[model samples]
Target: MTSITIDLSDSQFRKLQDFARVHGIAIEVLLKASLEDWLNLQKGDFVNTADYVLMKNAELYRRLA
Candidate 1:
């Protein structure tokens, strides 16, 4: 596993800490889960966009091929 350091504003850190405490999870776990969710969302968005573009340009792509 690799570790990383990030700089957060005091308010942001406080907010995260508060949220984590309420959720009964550690800050590290909260961050990891949040990061994973965000990455998955981004991946899904990219795939959807790519599919849309490919479908929209299918005819052009076939002609070019």
Candidate 2:
């Protein structure tokens, strides 16, 4: 694996460390999973189709009102 360096604010680093410990995972594992999830999100893996339908229904209601 390749190694890279990043800079995080104190609060962000603390939160990441806390989350890793609470989930019983290593910091590297947590970071990898988090990055994968973010990438998947960009790929539309976490689309909110339900919200779109609800918003359309709300527009219909507004038109009726």
Candidate number with greatest lDDT: 1
Segments in model 2 whose C-alpha atoms lie over 4 Å from true places? 45-65
Tens digit of per-residue lDDT, candidate 1, span 20-51: 99999999999999999999999999999999
Instruction: For candidate 2, give the lDDT.
Output: 0.87
Clashes of each: 0, 0
Model 1, residue pairs in steric clash: none
Model 2, residue 9: C-alpha shift (Å)? 1.3
The per-residue C-alpha lDDT of model 1 at residue 2 equals: 98
Model 2 TM-score relative to the real fold: 0.60
Candidate 2 at 45: error in angstroms? Answer: 6.6
